[model samples]
Target: MEFHLEHPLSHSSLHNDDADDNTLPLPLFLVEFQHMPSSHYFLTLKSSASLLSNRNFAISSITQYSRKFDDPSLTYLAVNYLDRFLSSEDMPQQQSKHWVLKLISLSCVSLSAKMRKPETSVCDLQVEGEMFDAQTIERMENVVLGALKWRMRSVTPFSFFSFFISLFDLKEEDPSLLKHSLRSQATDLTFNLQHDIKFLEYKPSVIAGAALLFNSSELCPLQFQCFSNRICQCTYVNKEELMECYKAIQERDAIGVEENEGSSETAVNVLDHQFSSCGESEKSITITAASSPKRRKTSTRRC
Candidate 1:
């Protein structure tokens, strides 16, 4: 889906469950992410225990497997499924063979594609020289779903993007167009940063905020100061913490986007970020950055 800055964002698509104008608080989200099914699911090389080397192998295999599909989102989603599944379950052989992990990677990509957008035609078992029969792939998918508790709608950094972006007074022709640009940049950074465990420390909302901040610095330098000031005024976001997260994100990308206390000179407004079941009391936190047209190579940590 193209993220148009000017495109109108529905609460359902942007928020988790058609959340109202008063979005959920960041603290609540942090707490939920900590315990929710997803909180346990991350794919850091070190987090793999003895599977460190094998984790790298899986990354390589999945990267190759991703090429078989036309949509990149399928790969990203499949990676999420793979990481989550690995978090709670073990390989059938438990590191007895390399092909086992490769099979898992294949199953993940295929299952992700099927879950996200199932095709009417039977899936092709062969990608390259390797082949996974339908039964084996289905068995793996069942294991993955069980591990994830069938929670396919994984809450991601993208979930909090709309609330954070709403804080910015980005009035333009079809704000959807601009929103898309910002969302696209943020999505790219999120995908690259997934391999690192450092990001897992922060809530997805905070990470989303940081991504928007970096995108703002890169794409909307002219309004960077204004955006920074407005975002800091948010009660839910500690200015220091958000800035710290933003710095980490930039360093990880190695793109070197600088942050300045620029101008709180811009008028700050309190946003009632009322998320689902978190109560309507939490109010007034804004975090959003405008989009940029330029693209830069992200220094992703391989392996």
Candidate 2:
């Protein structure tokens, strides 16, 4: 969709002196930004996860079977499948998480081999670190195709980024400015540095939402308000909750001293060790989702 910066005024309003005195023209940027709401973010995120899950299943299977004899172009092939899979909205949901990832990855490698080097066969994907046998990969591929009903197209995050970027009237000289801004916001989100929002798990959808929000704000103040409003309307999450999460991030980053003296590597290792203890079992997840049936599908797709 193209974003236009034109404002529409009624001829009657132009003729009426009282109307001119009482009404102010709405900003074009605000009008456009307000076209969609915040809930759109959640919806899009859910869709992305569902689509990516299939690709992951495909990739995993190919890598497992092709082990030591795996094709060199498998990675490229898998990524291609991912791109194609996410380009449309009709992707299907698979029952097993592992299956989805494996199938997508395998499809990617297969396509890559066909296009880049026709001599490459499916047997070439069997390399170490990837332990799926050829039969397993083939079975998973069949299962994925069935689950997806052969409709693999999906709209990926990259497309959303391009669409959102086009909404602003940025200058050529400041091309990198947007990237820098996005990077800064992402860093803040990841480290919990700028706000109280502490995202335990940084998913693609969350990143996309943050990127869009930050970009829109830079384009115009009204855009920020409208975008924020739209987000709220579409999502069950309230502004206050998001703000609180941002606040938690800020608080976490404001630590005065380290708990122990160690090198950076040691510090990272220690942190990882501490956080690794917080594991959740599949049964626990099932029980939790059961309590909130409305979120069951969402949790499965995302997790």
The TM-scores of all predictions, comma-separated, are 0.64, 0.34
lDDT of 1 by residue, 1-303 (tens): 332211213313565345553455554455435323234333333244445455556767777877656666666666666666665645431443678788778777766666555662226534666667778878877776777777565556666676677776665667777767887898888776665544544566667778897898787665666667776777766565566567666555553222211111111112123223323544222333222232111111111
lDDT of 1 at 80: 64
TM-score: which candidate is best? 1
lDDT of 2 at 221: 45
| Residue-level lDDT for 19 in candidate 2 | 34
The runs of at least 3 residues in candidate 1 whose Cα sits more than 4 Å from the true structure, single-residue gaps closed, are 1-44, 47-50, 89-96, 120-122, 171-178, 225-241, 255-303
Instruction: Please give the lDDT score at residue 155 for candidate 1.
Output: 58
RMSD of 1: 12.9
Candidate 1 local accuracy as lDDT? Answer: 0.57
> Candidate 2, 257: how far from true, in Å?
19
Error of 1 at 259 (Å): 22
Please report, in order, the local distance difference test score of every candidate based on alpha carbons.
Answer: 0.57, 0.37
